[model samples]
Target: MSRTSHITRTTGETGVDVQVGLDGSERTVEVATGVGFFDHMLHQLGKHGGFDLRINVKGDLHIDSHHTMEDTAIALGQAFAEALGDRRGVVRFADASVPLDEVLARSVVDLSGRPYMVHDEPVELAPMIGTDYPTSMTRHILESFAYHARICLHVSVLRAANPGQKPDAHHVVEAQFKSLARALKYATRIEGEDIPSTKGVL
Candidate 1:
């Protein structure tokens, strides 16, 4: 089965193009979004998910990173959903726990053709990772992706070993991305020829 999709989204505020190959083995990824930290996080997704992904985005960054980040998530989610293509023979459900230094994140995923997301991060982070990327946008990114992809997703920062200090923004976000990537990799695995749903569709 060829699970691949290319998507283009354009608006007054942003222009985004994405390509995804769910069954790809090369783990090839190329991303240019103008936001340095965001690009790094996206690379983690493709690398750990074992997917071939390419994303190019141009947005009105003169205003802020909001439009670019949100639009990218939407475009990526749409491409992922299109690549799934009836969800036949997919594992359909998975979970993963990932730790990065002082932070531990857990992600649970179900590709059930229903959109829902619950994201919880207890530790506080700095307002911005750098000059442009807002720390708050991390959860929003996952929520937007899950909504557009029609997937059930639950993510949480389950532990922080900071000893009464706030967690590092980079570690917190990286752990979430890694956990989500692992979960997605497992959920997209081909286990059999039949759909992994009871109602015969996903």
Candidate 2:
């Protein structure tokens, strides 16, 4: 089956459109919100999620990344929710553990139509490959994704003993995205036409 979705949103704050293909070849992301770091993070999300994602954001980024980032998450979440249709025989639950060298990260997701996030702090992680802004933006992105998509998400990083180890923010953030990708990949898979739950809805 062809699994794809297109979504559009416009408000006084922003104008956004996104197209995503779940069962497509690799990924191609085009995001220019003028937030350089946020763009990189979204690109990583698309690449590792194995989804062909194209996002266009026309927003007042001169203000900040808030509008761009939150709207992007909302659009993408709407796309996924639309593409999934009725939840239908999908796994609905998925988890992944990813390690970027010493920085290990884990993400767990449930397509349960309940929005929630549980994160473990420090909340401080060295960037995996980009600037600090996107690193901080990750938390907000995850929160928006879960809320708009009506999913439950939990993320945590185990405190490793190597306090002196050079913490690479880029690597840590990349690991987080990779973990999310794997978790989402499994969660969105289509198995049959059942509701994935005892109740006939998600």
Candidate 3:
């Protein structure tokens, strides 16, 4: 059985197209969102998670990166849910800790049908990553993903900055994305024939 999904989402703010393959190591990843650093982060998912991912988004960059990130998460999350189908025979729960220079981030996920998220990065950041990518919208993007994907997600920054030094916004956010990709890879892997939940459904 192949696990794959494709989605195209359009709103007044943005148009997003996403393709995903859960077990497609041989597949390629292509991402374009116009936000340079965000594109770099999404590439981390494709490269680190060892999955096929393609995302193309056209959003109102003149306003901000919000709409692009928002709709991309929406389309990607919906594609993930579609690919998983019944969510049976999967790991269902997984956690990953990743370190990037000055940042250490952790991501825990449960493939439950219910959607919830706990994001615990409480440090002050430098406002914007680039021209359009806002530093504050990181949580919003992940929140949208968890809701649309219908998964329980918890992400935190365990250690960042050094003594009195300020944290690097780029490293902080990149670590989270990398950890999230790794956790999702583990959680979505096929493991058995039955659902992992006690309720017999996920």
Candidate 4:
């Protein structure tokens, strides 16, 4: 099975095209979503997930980050769905435990056609340190991605993990990507496994 996919989408809000190869050794990330921080996060996602990604996007950022972020999720999710056609013979469930100094965050995923997200952490993030607005943007991005991609996601941060230590926002956000990468790695694995569904098709 070749883990390569190419997808293009042009919506009223955004236009995007992306190519991803899951089994590739060399990764190249090209993203132009008018959001530098978001682009960096996506690049981290690609690099850590062991996938090659190439992306081009044009969106109406003059209004807000909504269109760019949402459309990016939609495009990327569609690509992932197209790539994993039928979802056969693959590990369909995965979880990861990631820590960023004081923040011990975790994520779990189920590649099911049910879209859901459980953000079990407080929405308090330091200002001007990272993506400007981590709580809203990251949550929105992950939720939109899950819904569009038809996957289940759960993200949680351990309370009192490390108080009084203001961890870098970049590190905090990067931990999330690393967790995503680890979960995706397990979820996309071919384990000689069944379809992991009772409908006989997925």
Candidate 5:
């Protein structure tokens, strides 16, 4: 069976469309969220996770990027959950550590059918990575995604080496996204013919 899902979500704040294929190797990605940096991050997520993903969002950008970012995350999470189906024969837990220059990020994921998040950034970042991507919203995005996807996720910045200063926001955030992608990719892999849980369900 093909592990694929398409989702369209519309609210007073935004309209989002997302499509995802879990067992994909094409690394195909098309994302336009009205925020350049966010689009870049989503591309990284799909590429590194070995998933084909497409996202198109129209949001109330006249105010800020909050609605666009959060709504996109939610829709993407919904797509993932739908695609996963019964979560059978899957490696349900995984962790990854990724580094980019001076930033080292670690992410752990559990497809537990419950929403939970624990996020920590040891290094301070600039207020913004680009013209519109706020550093603060990074955690919120992860939280929103985990919540809607019903996954337990933990992400932490383990090390930031700049000899005495904070790492660049872009590098830090990129490393986190890459780590998350890798972790999720491993967790979602089809490993066996049964659900990977003691309770016989996820």
Candidate 6:
């Protein structure tokens, strides 16, 4: 089966476009969101998810990165949901745990056609990764994506820093995205011939 979707979302605050192939061999991906750190995280998602994903977004950056980040996630989430369609023959539920230096993150996902999310980040971040990407926007972005995609998602930072180690926002956040990517890859995989839920629809 072919699973792919292209979506465009234009609003007064932002304009976003996304293309996704859930089961592509090449995994060709391109993303340009004008936010450096956000772009890096999206790259991690695409690279680790083992899918073909593309995203382009333009927003009122003069105000802040909030609009751009949220809108990008919204469009990307819509693309994924569209690609999955009826959620046929997919794993539908998966989890992943990943560690990066001083940070460890775990993600669990269920594609139940319901939107719900729980995010827990115990580590204290530096507030901003750089001049553009705000660490506070991390939860907002993930929440927006899960809400739009109609998925049940739970993310937690199991580890952050030690006595001597310092909290690095990049590592902390990147670990979350990477773990989420793996979970999504597994959950979106075609593993069976029928829908995963008893309700007969997802």
Error of 5 at 64 (Å): 0.5
Off by over 4 Å in 2: 25-27, 124-134, 159-161
The global Cα lDDT (0 to 1) of model 6 is 0.92
**TM-score-best of 1 and 2:** 1
Model 4 alpha-carbon miss at residue 14, Å: 1.6
TM-scores, in order shown? 0.97, 0.88, 0.97, 0.88, 0.97, 0.97
How would you encode candidate 3's per-residue C-alpha lDDT over 1-202 as one tens digit per residue?
7889999998999999999998976668899999999899889988888789999999998988888998998888899999999998999999999999978999999999799999988558888887877888899989999998999999999988888999899889999999999999999999889989889998
lDDT string, candidate 6, 124-160, tens digits: 6898999999888999999999998999999999998
Q: In angstroms, give how far residue 131 of model 2 lies from its true place.
A: 6.3
Runs off by more than 4 Å, candidate 6: none
Candidate 4 ranges beyond 4 A from true positions:
127-134, 159-161, 165-168
**Number of the candidate with higher lDDT, 3 or 4:** 3
lDDT of 5: 0.93
Error of 6 at 26 (Å): 2.7
Model 5 TM-score (2 dp): 0.97
- What is the alpha-carbon lDDT for the whole of candidate 3? 0.91
In model 5, state the lDDT of residue 159: 81
lDDT of 4 by residue, 129-185 (tens): 344344466777888777876888997765324667555656666678678877887
Off by over 4 Å in 5: none
Cα RMSD (angstroms) for every candidate in the order listed: 0.9, 2.5, 0.9, 2.3, 1.0, 1.0
lDDT of each: 0.93, 0.78, 0.91, 0.76, 0.93, 0.92
RMSD (CA, Å), candidate 5 to true, equals 1.0
